[model samples]
Target: MTILICNSIIILITKTDPALQTPMYFFLRNFSFLEICYVTVTIPRMLVDLCTQKGNISFLSCAAQMCFVLMLGGVEFFLLTVMAYDCYVAIGNPLNYTIVMNQQVCVQMVAASWISVIPVVIGQTYQIFSLPFCGSNRINHFFCDIPPVLKLVCGEAFVNKIAVYIAVVFFVIIPFLLIIVSYGKIISNILKLTSARGRAKAFSTCSSHLTVVILFYGTASITYLEPKPNQYEGMGKLLSLFYTILIPTLNPIIYTLRNKDIIVALRKLLAKLLA
Candidate 1:
């Protein structure tokens, strides 16, 4: 509920305010909307389960949920990478930032993030659910994540294991590497600045995003970047809960607290409402 409210406010303010339409805030608006969808993909069902203690879902429903969640997660990973690149451009090439991150390119980046995941997610979800679920239908985790669901399937999951590794590479590691590279370039540019105040200003633009990247990638690394195939053995559910619930809840707080532009936008939004 808090995630819903906070992220909604972010989307609303970002959209309604003319001043918040830069490439960074454009990405942020999309991310806020994505968070709403992302958390909604699981939280309401989680609430229902908590209240009634009934978590069983039909095969079709389970497949649908897993497909949608994976698609959205893939889009988010792509969006985060795009955002990291946006930061890199803004900092490393401030003179050409406006031209390079023009409105058309921004829209293309966002559309590409959403569009590029459809085939990948569909193929991966098909492979995952294609396995026979002859074993216990009970998912060990609260949500319909791929890893826990795979555990319920019968037979040796060689194909599914490969799919999992591919997903880790495509959705997690690749984006993470891009973010690292973007920030590496950003740091190099920041170091080149002669003035301490100029350096601080450049660093400030990235600090909040860097914090979010660390928190997001850190939890995701624990969840998906396991060194071993069976690494999600004992603590998968706990880690998923942390990322799906706790992280979304914290994201709004993180941005609003650390970002002056968002704070200003929020204040202006509130004052307009109160007026």
Candidate 2:
């Protein structure tokens, strides 16, 4: 809750600024919003559990958690896809970049990513939530995730598992493939640049995004999609912490630090204030 509140306040200020309205900041705003919704879905219950240790989450609350965690997870996956596309266009097509990534198109890209997640997450959440928990109600993790919570149920959660698999295919595989494809073309375009300076600049613009992509996917795949058993109580917990807490916070910082235009704009704004 504290994290959510503090982030909300900061994001509110950032959003009201005219200058923080580019693709990077646009990504930052959406990422911040996702953080608010994401944390709210799980933390309050976890906080209650921490205080009381009894942890009696009602069925409805459990359903809500499942829905939101998957929802936000799906949303985050799609946002990364958009961010990758943004970088690809900015580096690969500088001349038509503004026209290609105009406000309307950017808005649509963000919207399409978000819109694509709803049906997929809703279907998966519904399958998992409606099942009978005729056995242990104790969720091992701090919050209700698909695997930890699924292990507690009595009957075969095969359908739920399948739904989860479908979501994995849609959320992880498809977007990941799209990212790879986009980067391939981006590299091809970068190679075609005649000047060494041009190639270096293109690579620098893409370097931060590729770094983030590798980190996020590396942790997520290892934690959630790995074949290993449930020993991830510690490692899984850490990885979960990364995607949940770390990514959103670090994204804005990555863009500001690495992107030259953003730094120049911010510096100009700061100089005006000092003057």
Candidate 3:
């Protein structure tokens, strides 16, 4: 609940403040919205199960949860990639940044991020659920993530596992690579600046975003990409909790606390309300 509210406040601050109308904050607003949806997908259910001591979830409900999780997670990576590009344009080509990242371009990029994930999520969900599940319908992890759920599948899930790896490459690794390339260019451009202040300012603009990218991709990679041994089942759940819950909780703090613009906007909004 706190994470949802904080992220909502980020969305509200960005949307309501005219100073936050740039392509970067535009993407930040969308990212905050994604954060809200991301936590909502898993945390509420986890809380319910904790309170009731009943971890039972219907197959259809589990499927729906997994679908939403995959979609939101995929879109988040795409949005981060877009944000990195936005930073690249702002720092690498300041003169044409406004013209290149105009309103239409930003909207199109966000739309692409949201729309591109649909097929992957749908296909992955269908492929996983369509498999046979005989005896011991227990999912080792908290939610219906790809690996644990795949473990429950009766027979050989090699093909399904392969499909999952392919999807991870597309949804996670590819976007992360794009972000890396964008940041590479951005760093090169920043180094070219003659003034130390200019370099500091440029890096400051991207530091929050870079922090978020690291936190998200780092935890996600560890959780999804690493080999999960039977002895490490508890460790797997802890990693899942980190990405699904902790990352969302930390995002608002990273963006708001680290960002001057967000702090100023928040103060201005608070002043107006108090007045």
- Return the lDDT, model 1, position 251: 85
lDDT-superior candidate, 2 or 3: 3
Candidate with more favorable, higher lDDT: 1 or 3:
3
For the record, the alpha-carbon RMSD of candidate 3 to the native fold, in angstroms, is 1.0
Ranking according to TM-score, highest score first: 3, 1, 2
Q: Write the per-residue lDDT of candidate 3 for residues 23-142, one digit (tens) a residue.
A: 999999899989888888998898898899989999999999999999999999899999999999999889999999999999999999999999889988998899999989888888
Model 1: per-residue lDDT, tens digit, 1-275?
79999999999888988888899999998998999999888999889889998887888888888888888878888998999999999998999999999999999999999888989898888888877789577787787888788778888887777878888788889899999999999999999999999999898898878887888778877776566646656676777887789988998898889888889989998898899
What TM-score would every model get versus the actual structure? 0.96, 0.84, 0.97
In model 1, which residue pairs have backbone atoms overlapping below 3 Å? none
- Candidate 2 Cα errors over 4 Å, as ranges: 1-21, 44-48, 51-54, 228-233, 264-275
Query: What stretches of model 3 exceed 4 Å from their correct place?
Result: 228-231
